[model samples]
Target: MKRICILLILLFIAFNNSFGQQVLKKGFLVACGDDKLFIIDPNKSNNNHTEIIWKWVVSEAKSLPAEYIPLLKSLDECKPVMGNKKILVNSSSGATILVDIASKDVEFYAKTPMSHSVDLLPKNRIVVANSTHPKGNSIELYDLNKNEKVLFTDSLYSGHGVVWNPKDNLLYVLGYQLLKTYSLINWDTENPSLKLESSWRISDKSGHDLFRIDADNFLISTHNSVFLFNTSIKSFTDFTLLKGKKDVKSVNYYPKNNSLIYTIAEESWWTENIYMVNPNKTIKLPNLKLYKVRKAI
Candidate 1:
């Protein structure tokens, strides 16, 4: 009887451990205008309750120079990269940095005019989308090993977002009223550049955010509404959930759980709240000036 009881207890503990492993760990990484990035649990976070699991302040970054602080003001993008081992972040204030998650070290940094989004590329390369500043309105490429030096530039009017699609091995860029794809030309060589392969007109003008939904689709937000662009079909369709919701600043969708988290520009270009659906939670960070929310991977 004693041996049977011990066996039952061990089985129970094993079962609980297996169940815990099956549960998904859900969290979000938010970029704020106050030059900070926060990873928070929406289920446990609210205006009165704070459940920030991790935070990074741009001005306090040890690897950044003192003078560069002013240029990284409005932290707009914080994207998980390198299999979530690192984060790629940039600001509308014209600075981008790749940070090591565990060490909190800035691995790569660049200064671009009105940089709104960024993505990693093959061969230690990075691409930035520059918006409507004097030196903006272009897609700029840089080497991670060489800081502050632009390797290449291509004109993309009012560029707002960039994402690398590994399935097709093309770089997708979002600009005013257009979504374009580029093939890497001479990437293995020192004189690397992007060759325009194709372009598609967005359903609306003022394209804002472009994020991968899966291998075949991308989540795009414009001034008027959000859409899903099918890479295979080369078409755009309204994202039914936020179909007509205007001024959506950023959006991320998890198909596994059918969950989504997004930010809307409520007060001009920023909001004080981050919203989630499919579970229906609102995480309010009063006075934080939240700009974008990407799923913490």
Candidate 2:
């Protein structure tokens, strides 16, 4: 028993990457819930948890009625967008916001009818999936240039998240009720065309989200597992986190340090700390909640 316990302890440290002391630095994770955004710096101390660096007050603006300003759902979308220091937030009533990290700039904001999930396309436009019942599977593409644009509402019953394939004008989608991918070749096509290339049949799957990591790779998260896939390879031998089985809720990837940012469900909002994944490490605490911990690509 002593030997077994000792081995487990060593493995725990190894998984957390304590041996090298190469803890994640500089970057932070942002999460949103009940209209508040949170920032976490893991590895400091359990006593010192993710703090609310800053927040955006969405009260009623006399002109636009802050009351009309949407409220964000999960902390996942609240975390910074991939390759950006800006955070992506969606209002329960259907507003999309991009919050800048350093400058604290609300760089952009758009309104939609989406319920829980939102995505920013390569064209600088935003897309959001609904939260209500199925049958109205629609993706609202919001154009900042004008308070309007086209919406892809065909065959999309519901969506968990949307991702832009930079290499090609394509969107990867996941949702509570379905998981599918659409090639937006029609965005610029004469008739505005979309091709349903590939998809996974999913039902009763909540908190499902799809994130684009690179041209050939992406990440998908569920209540209990997170997967990494290589589009080029079309096969994924992914990582399984020890976080509570509740749909990872959301996830983010940082391009600056090549790290995956993620959060686990906690009792108190503050208890939900964010961790940076160290892909090189192969061992860890059973069901450990970590971010940026991925395989060598």
Candidate 3:
């Protein structure tokens, strides 16, 4: 029994070491403003851990293709899209692009002025939100396989955040002060369409990101606070995560560690910050305007 236990311990240590080495190699992608994209390697510590083992810029001058110039000029949200296959990037210059992970290629691109958020779907479909400035208050579905054509559009007030929940098989869109749920009927066919399932007021001003907690509930970041939204009953329970004039940018849930990671930026875009809410911790990052946080898969 003692020898068996010793072998198991050794195996576990080997597995952990292998995983850590893999992280040190590729790290995680972080999209900072002004054409900066970094691969950060996070290391664990016994106390307050802010030490990044190693990191390098991936979206450098040479890596960006000519077509991606506009996107690099003013990148907003940079996180791995659905399935962790490509990075979904939204830009202030009105571009939505999907970058291939291995090839470093901008596989898909679209011009969506004032585009705030995006959600990837099956069959090369993407749902995007336009919040303010040029052509605001709209949610659109673009078919990438079909020359980036608009397949659907719904009028919502200052549409900002969009997410596709596989649990309820619905698309949740957040606007200035509302949450709209839609049932994607006949989505697999050529005649795909969205039916309005429900709509409700979520906040007084504007709402930001939507992080799925589970099939029954999710979390929402807004101008005032973070809110827990239940899908079962279609209700909201508030959590005071934001305060004192700080605007929330994104909230992401980490399933492996069972934690929540969120970002907040000043109204004037002076600071980009990250906080671990579950453990009540903060991760140090370079001075750059960031958008979203996603766990590296």
Candidate 4:
């Protein structure tokens, strides 16, 4: 009994120390840009110019599989999946891939012309959007319970951003000039389908990304500016974080850590041509232009 008690005490101390020594309080931010992906730690790196903790280049990805070779072109959206153990990436060249963080094992799920964004849903369903290609200009839902299979389809023009919000049981999709919300009822059933609930005109040109500020609020990125949409009021208030440039690509909000990371591009695709927006100011890095940014938390 005394030996067992001593072992328990030691385990408790080790657990406590691990938690106390945790440094990446805001977790890591995965930024995907032109054929490259970077992991940035907010708490550890310099606030002025945060360094990338890790990076994956196109050369390494091209060696994986012949099907995944297309993923080497214009990697737009990279999202942490399965508790940041893996990453789901969407490229402009009709490739949707999920990669293991440790082994770098790649899984090619679906292909569409100009695939832009992918969001993980309940029951291992992956929802994807394609920006170009006439046949691919629609929202495609794939079920990964067994193999990847098309479960549903909804038509949209310039489909770019998609997010499944459990707070209101709604799936929000963004097109070029319209924002649509669908009721995610019957989602757990075999024949589950989303019903269109609401639609709004967000931008006349390009709508880029969506960040959930809360249960009833969201920050939407566009080619012109960012807008805060209030679900209760069904109205939009433009918050132009960038004054002169219309290149704000992505925004990620970490509520637990009270941190926000956004990317803006200038004339080039280099990180020096991009800026990372913090709460008070923006930090410029000499790296690749970031297309999508996601907090690992």
lDDT (Cα) of model 1: 0.84
- Residue range with the least summed lDDT across 10 consecutive positions in model 1: 19-28
lDDT of each: 0.84, 0.52, 0.67, 0.71
| lDDT for residue 8 in candidate 4, whole number 0-100 | 100
* Model 1 residue pairs with clashes: none
- Counting clashing residue pairs in each candidate, in order, gives 0, 22, 0, 2
Identify the runs in model 1 with alpha carbons over 4 angstroms from their true place: 1-28, 46-48
Top TM-score prediction, candidate number: 1
Give lDDT: candidate 2, residue 222: 65
Question: Per-residue lDDT for 44-86 in model 2, tens only?
Answer: 3243333333444444122243434543332225534534445
lDDT at 174, model 3: 88
- Candidate 4 lDDT trough over 10 residues, lowest sum: 268-277
Which portions of model 2 miss their true places by more than 4 Å?
1-26, 39-46, 49-52, 60-64, 70-76, 79-86, 99-114, 133-136, 148-150, 186-193, 202-204, 236-238, 241-246, 253-260, 266-271, 275-297
Candidate 1 lDDT, 99-191, residue by residue in tens = 775556788888888999999999979999999999899999999899899999999999999999999999999999999999999988998
Candidate number that wins on lDDT, 2 or 3? 3
Ranking by TM-score: 1, 4, 3, 2
